[model samples]
Target: MTQPTPDHHGIIYRRAALDEGYTDKQLTRRVDDATMTRIWSGAYVLNTGETRTPEELHRLTAIAAVTSSPDSGFALSHQSAGVLHGLSLLTPQLDRVHLSTGYATGARLEKRRHLHSGALDDADTVVVDGIRVTSLERTVVDIACSVGFAQALAAFDSALRNGADAAVIAEYLEGHKRGVGQARRALGHADAGAENAGESWGRAQLICAGLPTPRLQHEFYDDAGVFIARTDYDWLGKLAAEFDGMAKYQRHLADGETAFDAMRREKEREDALRRLGVMVIRWVWEDLRRNRVVPMVREWLDRLGIAA
Candidate 1:
């Protein structure tokens, strides 16, 4: 078969060889430009102006393409599905593609692909752009079962905020009889106001320590009736607690700036809030995981004449 000329987007491996058989040597010789870039091992691009690949879409497409037999089917699983469904507040660190199927099938993938075996019901699954994916509720349950508690809570929060019904998820869990316990527990602890995983974990820690639950994503208004600032958590009356996630602050640091400019900005924000009669207590990742934060929080509450 004769090789087709490269299109405007350049030649992709699947398109170049799948349509008409083209030997590897012939395809390689066609692209004499050294500027041609290799995305994965086989995927290549000749034009630099070509649009970059969307990672989520690429993952989904790979899963669909790999399932060649009737017994071979895949569902987007875990955090990967969460990202595709827009239930993830933060980007996933791991790039592995997750797939579920009843039959074992293998393919060379650009990234690690995890496989799970089970009969997927209609309610637990949905089709997105011709690809089967775990439903929003199922995705949340899978995340709760697989990832850390903090990440689970964040996923739950994003799902809730995006119009996922907690009751529907609960019913799905009950009927499925798989991961029901985890679903129930996660539902009980899920807080939509958690902006990130660290804040969610910090809230859970405080609750476990018997400290009174503070207002989440609480907004503070100045005396002039203007919105001054908002905090992750705020103790009503006098003592105010704020969870300072390390991830939150590190996101603001410059590439190599050694000066404490970020610290100075935080101090300013705190002082402004304090001027409005709100006592600010900051908690970081280490403090949240340890027992010290509990007592420190309680002490601040007691000093402010607020019962803890």
Candidate 2:
């Protein structure tokens, strides 16, 4: 194996490091020097950049898990499979990658890998990006089993948006009894209108709080037929919830405009919606992370008599 360049974004297994003539002491020295980052046990990152998301890093770790595995028969499954397949899901745990040996199994949790001993049918496995991964259907099923209903529903929604066939997923779900109830319930609730993880997280929080499912990607227009705005979530066409992420404002900049211009335009847009008799409620990432979004939105919905 060749040594990875400093800009390499892929996972580098321990064997690759050894083959590249990096001794154990040298590896530790590199880590101490901040030249290499160990994403998981025996898996080091040769590249360092700010653009990678948690999901992206977890996928690299999954690849590393595959490369470092002593067993030749293991396949990436569960959250690792979800990451590799590019299914949008929350990766709360980036320290480990989930793997399956595809045999009648034992559950093993190591420092860097979570192993599932359950055997997989040929139908559930597919090669993605030069590695074996659970099929989208199988991945969703595994996520539903592993991450609980709300989160799995979020991933399932993204998979569907990314072109996973809903019928096929349902068909695959037939024989899977584990977590079937939560899976089915989440299926009924999943919506592709969730454009990002924040929106999905917000929806899941509301659902968990026993709030009614809000309509997503709702568009509004003035009486004269002027398009006003599309909101993240809407209820009864009178109340709206917007995920006010900071990156969203950055997306507003054009060739000459500044961040201030973006903020001004956003406020004007909100004002226009207000003129159309719509009330917009906004929350940021902090609110979502602090678990205040559900309560805040619930307060609005309660006033509007919609969060039943």
Candidate 3:
């Protein structure tokens, strides 16, 4: 069996394997037995478990692809960089790894990777998870140029939450007008207070649905001024929206608590909010998938008789 070095980022390169005294046949056996996953031709990541979602596999591919090539030759960009930076990508393209090269590669497409050729200045790159990747500002500009408005807003919102400076994003946009206008529109909708990709996605849906923008991470208090809960989104006294996901559900758990216990705690929180006569709406991943979020949320807005 091959053991990865401390420096390895959850994957082992064949060259590194050889240096560690493993033969090709031995490594091949490991792959055959499900102990290793061959990500690229000569790159492997441990396969102790299955990739639960397409997003997980995409992230693994992006990181493994970085080590598959000559380390100094590729800089992670776009959604790949987002993955490395721990930023939430709403709907990332999973088919290809995105890389930036210092030289003019021009075409920007490869079978398993998309190589974007540009002037890669040191100032525009940052090392993340031991790999070179585009800075948050550059990443925002890159995704804004390529994806739809909602997807772009999700990336921008996550970027801000992960410490991307708004002024810095603007500074990078100078002289880089290819998609600056579109990016500006997305930025206008971006909120740093969006706690995760789900909230960002919800915000994007509200924007596309032509619903009034809701305040993010708003706190509420009871009649005696005791705190109730800090909501994911607030239409200020009208409606509060929570993008309900597994992550949100898990948060309901106290340490060592069971699933039912978590649900009980969440029920309590919801009840407390309702006793204040506040309308609360919750959506899950399925809502986003079927495009039902818009009409469903719109219904809530109308039913509540809230102008927003």
- Give the count of colliding residue pairs in each prediction: 0, 0, 0
Worst 10 residues of 3 by lDDT: 1-10
* Cα-based lDDT at residue 12, candidate 3: 77
Candidate 3 residue lDDT tens string, 1-308: 44554235566788888888888998889889888878787888787676646666676778777766765677989888877777787778768898888776564687998887778788889988777899888887788778888788888888898889988887776756577777788888888898777778878888977898888888888999999888888775768878883457786667899888777777788788899987888888888878877887788888888675
Note each model's CA RMSD in angstroms. Answer: 6.5, 3.2, 2.4
- Model 2, runs deviating above 4 Å: 1-9, 12-28, 39-43, 49-52, 289-291, 305-307
TM-score of each: 0.68, 0.85, 0.90
Name every residue pair that clashes in candidate 2. Answer: none
Candidates sorted by lDDT, best first = 3, 2, 1
Q: lDDT of all predictions, in order shown? A: 0.65, 0.78, 0.79
Compose the digit string of candidate 1's lDDT tens values, residues 1-308: 34445433343664556466766765567455444444444555454455644554444334433333244456776666776676644335345666666343453344456666666777778875555778888777777665555566677877887778898777666754555565566677787787766666666666667778778888888878987777878888356666664346657788774347667666777888889888988877678667567788888877887776
- The 10-residue segment with the lowest total lDDT in model 2: 1-10
Displacement of residue 99 (Cα, Å) in model 2 is: 0.5
